[model samples]
Target chain A: MPFFEAVRLALAQIRVQKLKSFFTLLGVMIGVMFLIAVVSIVQGMGNYVEDAFAGKFLGVNTFNVRRFPDFNMGDVTEAEWRAWQRRPLVTVEDAMAIRDALPAGTRWAIEDARWLAAQSPYVASGPQALVQAVTPEYFAIKNLVVTQGRAFNEQEDRLGAPVVVIGTEVAEHFFPALDPIGKELRIGGLPFRVIGVLEKQGTVFGVPLDRQVLGPFHSALHRFTGARRGLYGVVVQAPSAEAMPEVQATVRELMRRRHKLRPAQDDDFVLESSESALTTWASIKRYLVLAGIFLPAIGLVVGAMVIMNIMLVAVAERTREIGIRKSLGARRRDIMAQFLVEASTLSTFGAAIGIGLGIGLSKLVAAVSPLPASVATWSIGVAVLLGAGVGIVAGIYPAGRASRLDPVVALRAD
Target chain B: MTADAHELAGLSTTGERQAVIGATGAAPGKDWVIVTRGIRRDYDMGGEVVHALRGVDLAVRRNEYVAIMGPSGSGKSTLMNIIGCLDTPTAGEYWLNGVLVSAMKDDELARVRNREIGFVFQTFNLLPRATALHNVELPLVYAGVPAAERKRRAIEALERVQLADRMDHRPNELSGGQRQRVAIARALINNPAILLADEPTGNLDSQTSEEIMRVFEGLANSGQTVIMVTHEPDIAAHARRVVVLRDGRISSDERRDAFVSKLAATI
Candidate 1:
């Protein structure tokens, strides 16, 4: 028989037994649903980390030079911690050497930060906020724009001015219903004049980014944060993406020479770019995506077995029908094609439902939670092919058995 | 049989049938629709060879309406299956439409059955889920007829059986007589060289049986060759010629009047 005719016949059979057909395809449907949902979530996390997390925590075309690695994913053992503590801190001379040796277009800043309780006259007691001491170029490199007042200039750093730039959350809490610029905010019994209110920076991974205060690295804020012992770190910005590796290489060489490290020893300090910062997350995401596929693959296997079982039953029930068709000039391949089409049609239908449900589930997850989801077109394509392939595999034995039946015996079946 | 009976009813004489059956390795003439020379079928019943058909010779001509009547285990069913191309004879030559078909393989026989034989079963073996139109269109579907033409031809065949108005109804919804007519329509859809029926009226009431008989009579009058297998003397009497099988061999071959008189005498 023609291919379309067999498919039509199979569809009619399924329609005649709607409830059975639904049960038959349930496994495939659920499998596909989870497949789509998990992949979507993993893909969403990947996008968010690449687009938002990196941009917020690490500036564009920027790398950080620190005494030890920041954003380490794994736990640091006791031995590793002692070794890191024994290394010399990033000092003012090292910062100046990196600044002078680097090309003119490169921007650099040294910053120190600590979370400290703050007090303002309007609010006698307030939340502990991140207080940072940074050079004047820090604002430009970090893209921190002041919506209200002006940022501190180069003269403030040279003169050791105590002017401060406060983030939106700090502004809201310390000076509620009042302009925060030109106000006094005291930290550790030292008062600093607020010169600017920085623009809002949204949270990353549920940690608020706007609860901050910035002052000149020359001010007393460094004493509170222990930067007086040694500077926290220097932030460097390359002019372009291509210049970042060269700049990092030059800094590594410069830092090693200053620290007097031998050729056999590792560098005492760490240089971290956004790419390096994301390496741990990339590996984690790969495992998540594989787990997403593996779990759903189990569901698909179960679904395939269900379909095979159902097809075998259908062949048995339709033996007489097979006989009738054989009597009407149907070849063995005709009967084989009929049952195969039925099995695949049933399976593919399950997969399509799965795709729809998977997308809905991902969308629901995105809506109710912070996770953002976008459906992968390639995943949908894979799901559809998988559904069809499962059906074809499941249909083989039953279809073969149906085709090999003797017409005389089959016609006599009840 | 005499020349007058051959001229009046288009029946082949015993001498003519013998001549066609004796041509062992050769194809029959164009006039012969079915010719079997010593066709035999055997069954292995747990290490015992039970012979179902013991060298039965039969010949049928085009446009001849004949009935083969016998009791249970008389090998009439075996003869019907061989003539219908549903089963090949285990021994001896069988020819249909001037072709030697006894040695043909499974798929080849399926093709021959598709093009040359149509079957009407006793139980009206229609696909219960399909509508009358779809049921009639089945043979043509396997014949690879395109959808539009298949539908058109199915409608025409249903119209021939006067069941076109009921084409959308399923087998369960149709009356016994109507279902049989639908089976008839399905059988004739391919315009096969021979219409083979197995107890075609067994499931119907007497009135419905008569209604089915009239349809078969009309088909035979239109020059369609038909072979009916039955054990009922009255049903066998409807055919132009009747052949009786006793102990796997032909006991009598006579015209319808002779068969009716013999049946009446026995009664």
Candidate 2:
């Protein structure tokens, strides 16, 4: 029979049994919907990490030295955590020693970071911000641009000057009507005059990039409550991208010598580059993507099984119809083609609905939450093809059975 | 075609029919629509062999309206199946429209069935969900006719059965006689060489049965070969000739007038 005629017949059958068709297609719809929604969200997160964390926050050719090896605390074992705790703190003296040992063009900065709210006696309730006590070169090492006034001078940093640089959010909240460069703000009960206001930076992973206050490292260590506990890190910047590896090796060697560690012992300090961080994130993202694909694949398998069962039932129900078609000169291939078309029609319909629903869900998530989400065009294509593949795989046995039916026996079937 | 009726009448004896029909692979002339020589069909029911047809020899010429009648176990249905190209005989030669179809493969038989035979079943056998017009277009669809041509021929066939006004109605919406007329139109859509009707009016009332018989009469009168299978003597009387089967073999073959008189005398 003609291809169009078979399609027409299959459509008519679906229409005649509307409820059954809907239930049969629902499995594929839900499976595809879950697949698309999760994949889209994961893809959006990957973009978010790439843009906000890898590109903007961590500058090129820059690396950090910390007491702990990994960024997140929960990822390390108990013994590893104890070992890291036993290691000596990364002090400002160590930072200076590393800088002196590096190439002349390289720069380094030390910071004692803490979450502390800044308040102004001029305003009723001031914004809470992450406070970083750092040396003057920290701005240059971290690639932070000051939009107003100027960064603290070396003399002021050395004398533990009571000068501060406020981020864009702190400036906007504490001194909205006045130029914030010369304003005085109290951070953790210590009063400091703002010498500069940094340019606006966007959020990263839900943390506001602009909500921070920078103070002279010496001044903060003397005034802040937790500064004496020795929680501090060093940021180093190579003169160029090509010098990064050598600079890192020199810094590691210099730190090991300064600490007087034995040659057989592992280095107590952790050195992390922006490239290394991004590589770790990429590997994690790969696992997320695999999980996103694999979990929904279970749903697709179940949907395919449902399709196979329904197709088998349909074949049995249409035995006499098959016989009639055979008698009217439909070959086995024709019968097989007809059933296969019907199965694919069922699945493709589900896929279309699934694509729409998945996109709708992603849009809803974007609207309702802080997490980013986007539907990749390629993911949509893969999802639709997967649905069709399920249909073809599920249709094979039943269509083959229909094709192999004995026409004489089928015609005699009641 | 009518001039060959005398030669067909002369080959009446069983041995004479075999000699005329020849053995397997012999070429049949154009005037012969169907010829079966020593055709046998066997069925294996769980290792027990039951012979359905026992060396039956039959010949049907073009434009002949013949009915094969028998009791339930007489194997008349088996003979009809072979004649319609729906089945191949177990052992023997069967020819239809000058082709040796018994030796043909399944797909070859399908093509032969499409090109040379049209079937009307007792149940009307129209696709229940399709409109009368689409049902009538089915055979032409299998024959690979183009859409416009198929539509035109289907409409023309429906008009021939005087169902033009009801072309869009489904089988369930039409009366028994209308449904049968639609089936008949479908059977004739491809203009096949033979119109094979199996108990065509078995499910209809007597009035509807006569209406269906009249349609067959019109088709046979217009030089179409028709082979009908039925157990009803009255229905068999509608044909120009009757061939009765008993115990998987032909028991009697006679003109319609002679069979009717015999039926009347027996009653």
* DockQ, all candidates in order: 0.72, 0.73
Please give the RMSD of candidate 1 to the true structure.
Answer: 2.6
Encode model 1's per-residue lDDT on A1-414: one tens digit a residue.
677766787677678889988888899999999999999999898888788877777888899889988777675788999999998999878888999889879999988888998888898787788888899999988888899899999999878898899989999998999998889999888888999998998777776778889999888888898885777789999999999999999999999999999999999999977898789688778788889988889989999999999999999999999999888988888888888888898898899999999999999999987779878998899999999899999999999999988888888899
Q: Against the correct fold, how does model 1 do in TM-score?
A: 0.93
Lowest summed lDDT across 10 adjacent residues in model 1 chain A is found at A1-10
Give the CAPRI class of candidate 2: medium
TM-score of each: 0.93, 0.91
Report the Cα lDDT for residue B198, model 1: 95
**Colliding residue pairs in candidate 1:** none
Which candidate gets the maximum DockQ versus the true structure?
2
- What shift in Å separates residue A236 of candidate 1 from its native position after superposition? 0.9
Q: Which candidate is the best by TM-score?
A: 1
Given the true complex, what DockQ would model 2 score? 0.73
- Residues A179-206 of candidate 2 have per-residue lDDT tens digits of 8877789876767999998989867766
